[model samples]
Target: MSIDQVIEQVQAVYGSWGRETTVAQMRADWDRLFGETVSPDSSQPVDADGVCAAWIDAPEIDRDRVLLYFHGGGFQVGSVRSHFDLMHRLSAAARCRVLAVDYRLAPEHIFPAALDDALSAYAWLLEQGVPATNIALAGDSAGGGLALSLLLQLREAGMALPASAAVMSAWTDMTASGESYQTRADSDPIHQRRMVLAMAGNYLGQQDASDPRVSPLFAELQGLPPLLLQVGDRETVLDDSRMFAHKAQAAGVAVQLQVYDAMIHVFQQFPQHLTQAQEAIAAVGQHLEAHWPPHSNPYNS
Candidate 1:
């Protein structure tokens, strides 16, 4: 699809934003928009950690591999509910269950708190007997950055890592120095440079943007699991994925980078209305199935 066509479709669905809106209002709007499109049957009750809201969907063939998902909203919005449809489709396609984490957001919790919640959820999964080999971490936007950051943290802590990870439109660089920031700043549909800067300010209050967890693309990349990155060609943060993939490959990590032409940030949000979005999510499911095969189910042991 051409960039203009994509933008028109997105703008049709989501009109001009209200500058005075809060994250809570955005969350409510998202709920109203996607409530009927998503199947509620897949939802599970929240876990006791008080840091995450999780859901488990059992596949027909019993693939023991689990996908631990983190939703994206620039670290200030989004929840497990916001990503229910994507998670459901992924779970069905991979023939495995998915555990969506509702990590704490920023501007309220700030840096490290979201990271801490993500790590805690992963630890909880491990404690539940989900083998590292049978697990795959996935997310989009800020959540995508978090997934990679979590993998880095796990490696540093000498913990078992997930078999692989799939990240889409990841905002891996808080410094936002990428060439795309200037080149694609005006072309992207959903995100604006000013908005990104504001979100970054909220996420990194009084903290260094250079911190590895806050910016995974700048972190040490060795010893991390195989990774699959799906990025839109028009996103301002396109260079974030580009640089991360380049560095990871140079560091000897297996990486697949799929750059979709003329797409915008997190295109999967329109799976119901856009063929491209459906295709993108299918690609993600395929990548997960390839790296974390159902036969590797540790539950059978």
Candidate 2:
């Protein structure tokens, strides 16, 4: 279907019409829209230090190479199950096992809690003999922001970097300062400025919103590994991706920024009905393959 049609379908399925606003209900809806990968090749739960996580495996996936994923839910709701299908598909497409992290969410677990879980997950991978070169960090929305923050923390700590990273419609600005929030206010069907601001507040708690750790848009982007940044044109956070790309490039980080025209946020997650979504996912696989290469994977043991 065309992008407009895809947007309309997305609106029908996910729009705010009669949608419950409570956290409990929001979570229930998220689960229904994107259910678990019940029949994935394998799904194993794990303990990452104090964090909870799981492995989403697919057939023919490279054993050594792994895609470490963080789920997005405004840092409030979302779990490994909530994003299992996306992780499983990413593994299948990238030909690598996916470690879907169940990072702590906000209100109870605010800023740095989720980031801590992400770092802990990455550290767990390293401690498990998973070479940093064989791993990649990925997430959508808030998770994407966490991925970028984790990279900065890792680099600052002198830790070895992952092979690459991928993010989808990443909400990089905690301040909701992007122009798209205003310009795309009516066109974007998924997000709004006030809502995003509240979500950011929920995640930040007493933390500084402008801190690079909280908002990667304000982060020092130098020395990051290759990245695949995808955002939809119809998204209210469109400027997040656009500004991030320009800054990342200026920081000498190689980035492949894919802006799908007329599409809404996280459109890649709707591959079941959107062909563009599938194609976008395929591009992720190609990007990962180029960086890690097949067969030569560290998991080839």
Best by lDDT: 2
**Candidate 2, residues 128-215: lDDT per residue as tens digits?**
9989989998999988988989999999999999999999999888888888999999988769998899889988889999999988
Q: Tens digit of lDDT per residue, candidate 1, span 1-301?
A: 5556656755754574577877777667666555545556658866826666676674563447789888888998787677888887888766677889988887788998888888988888888888898889999999999999999999999999999999999989988889998899777876777778788899998888878989998898998888999998889999999999999999999999999887888887767767788888888878887887547443331
- What C-alpha RMSD separates each model from the true structure? 2.6, 2.4
TM for every model, in the order presented, reads: 0.91, 0.92
Global Cα lDDT for candidate 1: 0.83
**Where is model 2 more than 4 Å wrong at Cα?**
1-21, 36-42, 297-301
Clashes of 2: 1
Off by over 4 Å in 1: 1-16, 39-41, 58-63, 293-301
